[model samples]
Target: MDKVFIKDLEIETIIGIFGWEREVKQIVRISLEMSFDISKAGKSDLIEDALDYKKIGKSIVNLVENSSFFLVEKMAEEIAKLVLKNKQIKDILLKVEKPGALRGSKSVGVNIFRKQ
Candidate 1:
């Protein structure tokens, strides 16, 4: 299967379980890998035959900015579901990072996979 990926997508949104966190927006990094058979698209060399990554990116950004989640796990799960819902995607791996969530650690987040 061919793969379509988006990496280091950063978005600011209201997230976290803490009261202070809910009151403000925090930066989250989202990375996604989706599997699809793009041979047809490649052969045709048509944009319409291929997955529109720009649209996907915009949709994800909207999803993150317009919603609130207390945990990265939930966010990751939702993203996974969204990807799997697309018929072209056979599977997906989603990683979400919350930078500076811990004092000593660089970031904390979750990685999840969903198979269609």
Candidate 2:
């Protein structure tokens, strides 16, 4: 299947397991690779025939920015559920990372796969 992807989409929200983390919002980077067949769009060469990636990305960013969660795992699951609402997507590879969450690590987070 063909894929549509967005990388390093950052949004600020309260996310963590600690007391201090719940008090402040931190930036979380998100990456999503959605499996979608682009054949129709490619053939029609029309924006209407294509998957509206910008709209999808904006919705996800808005959702994440407005919500608070203690775990990235839960966040990932929620995002997958929301994205899978689009019937065009067959599966997805989703990654959520909190940069600087670990002292020596570049970033820490989870990667999850969801299928329709």
Candidate 3:
């Protein structure tokens, strides 16, 4: 299968187990690789024949911004579920990270893969 990817999509949301975390919005970076067949779009050169990545990204933005979750694991799972809702997507590799969440690390997060 071919792939479409979105990288470093940053969104602010309430995410963490800490009391202060729930009080303020924190930035989470999301990246994803979606399995798709792009031959038709490549050959036809038409929007109708292609996976609408912009639409998908907007939807993910909406979902994440409106959600309050304590773990990046849940965020990743939810993103995978949302992406897999499109029948065209056979599989998804999702990563959700919180930058500067740890003292010694650049970021901390979870990565998950799911298939339909």
Best by TM-score: 3
- lDDT per model vs. reference: 0.91, 0.94, 0.94
Candidate 1 C-alpha error for residue 72, in Å: 0.5
Q: Against the hidden true structure, what lDDT does model 1 obtain?
A: 0.91
lDDT by residue for model 3 (1-116), tens: 89999999999999999999999999999999999999999999999999999999999999999999999999889889988999989999888999999999999998888999
Ten residues in sequence with the least summed lDDT for candidate 1? 78-87
RMSD of each: 0.9, 0.7, 0.6
In order of TM-score, best first, we have 3, 2, 1
Q: Residue 50 lDDT in model 1?
A: 92
Which stretches of model 2 miss by more than 4 angstroms? none
TM-score of 2: 0.97
Q: Candidate 1 residues 1-116, lDDT tens each?
A: 77899999999999999999999999999999899889989899999999988988988999999989999999988878776778888898889999999999989999887897
Worst 10 contiguous positions by lDDT, candidate 3: 74-83
- Report the CA-based lDDT of candidate 2 relative to the real structure: 0.94
Using TM-score as the measure, name the better of candidate 1 and candidate 3.
Answer: 3
- Give per-residue lDDT, candidate 2, residue 91: 96
